[model samples]
Target: MSSSSAEVLLVRTGAAATLDRTSVGGRGTVASALVKTPRLGAVSVGELGFQGDVQADLEVHGGPAKAVLVYSDEHYDDWVAELGRDLRGTGLGENLRIRGLTERDVCPGDRIAVGSALFRVSAPRRPCYKLALAHGIRDLSARVQRSGRTGFYLAVDRPGEVRAGDRIAIIEHAPHRISAFEVNRVINLDKRDVDGARRVLTAAADLPPRWVAKLRRRVDGAVESDASDTARLYGTD
Candidate 1:
């Protein structure tokens, strides 16, 4: 791979290289690639934590049309489930299955070039019970309460088109220290980072200052999300 390129892999919705783009309910066509932006933090499918390409731009009812995409971690532990005795990856309902892009490696404002689709890393996606249920898992909220590998969010920096199997390339932005993983960890804590909250907005154009201050107060100093033993493997905690 070229120094400017990274091997990005995702399961194609179909075997086709290009897809039709539409809203959630609509019959979405396959694309060469997609983009994501952070609206919330922490994405969990079933019982896994992960990062990267957290969401894809969708035509929403009222919103700007960003939705959480689903994908299963390919290289994960397998076990028997109550529904069926089988090996299961992280119990996440990611539209695009991710392999190498650990949550910490990418941050908001970072752009990824998959095939021809230019996606801007918006922020980290938040985990909710809906995700768990979607994947036939239980207590997804609780699992995320313990693990903060929420999916990342993206905004189409330069929307072209995308699909699975396209290679993802990193296009860097300024103040690249904070990553989606770190942002998720710090923001979820009981205490908040007043400064950090504000700093993140710099990367995201839509986020307001009030929200940032609110986050700092939540984290206070202790950066724990689900459990008090909050530690991060991707970005700084």
Candidate 2:
């Protein structure tokens, strides 16, 4: 999709973000909403069967919308963050549509302008099991690795109100040469059993070398056994 065609719009929140999970797949609108968090930025999904209602808000933070982790890639259906693309315009159940934009085009720490609303890419989206079955998409986990279009985690850069049909523009917020996806890809290439969990470990394990040390211990122990390090990292023991 072309950058000029890039757009971000706001739809009502059908669900809320979990305090524990930045994003979640559920049956209906979230019963609870954060009292303080803004709901406009959250990415809400209707029942997780794929190609269904999906929305991204343009304003506010702290509520469920701010919590949604999102991503896009041009190589695939782009359902990674967009619901309409997967449905093939069968009519996007999505509350909002991002046109001509997917995870591949966004850069980490980049600020996106959707009218008066602004959002920054916080991190990369992790593939969950439900996304696989809901969309009936095969090799999704692997696709993330090969495509490098892994969707992004968003943080509210500027809080404001947004609505559908709003044009969105991406603004660079960081001078860093590496993107979160690039770092993840490098780590995935070097390590085995590298999934979302492992990616987090590799990305953050550096904060506390002791944590990395602890992982080293667990990884070594798993290697001695029949299990792979990735399995142990995921607590598959």
Overall lDDT per candidate, in order of appearance:
0.44, 0.42
- Please give each candidate's TM-score: 0.55, 0.50
lDDT of 1 by residue, 5-107 (tens): 4443443221113323222222444332222232232222221112233222232101222322423243233223323433233334344555557556776
For candidate 2, the clash count comes to: 17
Error of 1 at 15 (Å): 18
Tell me how far the alpha carbon of residue 163 in candidate 2 is from the true structure, in angstroms, after superposition: 2.2
Report the CA-based lDDT of candidate 2 relative to the real structure.
Answer: 0.42
lDDT by residue for model 2 over 1-237, one digit each (tens)? Answer: 655676554343344332222133323332222211123543323222112222322332223323334433243355435434453321112233455666546555566765565676655543332233233343444455455655555555555655556676766645553355654453343334334334445434222243345335545543234244333122110
RMSD to truth, every model: 11.9, 10.0
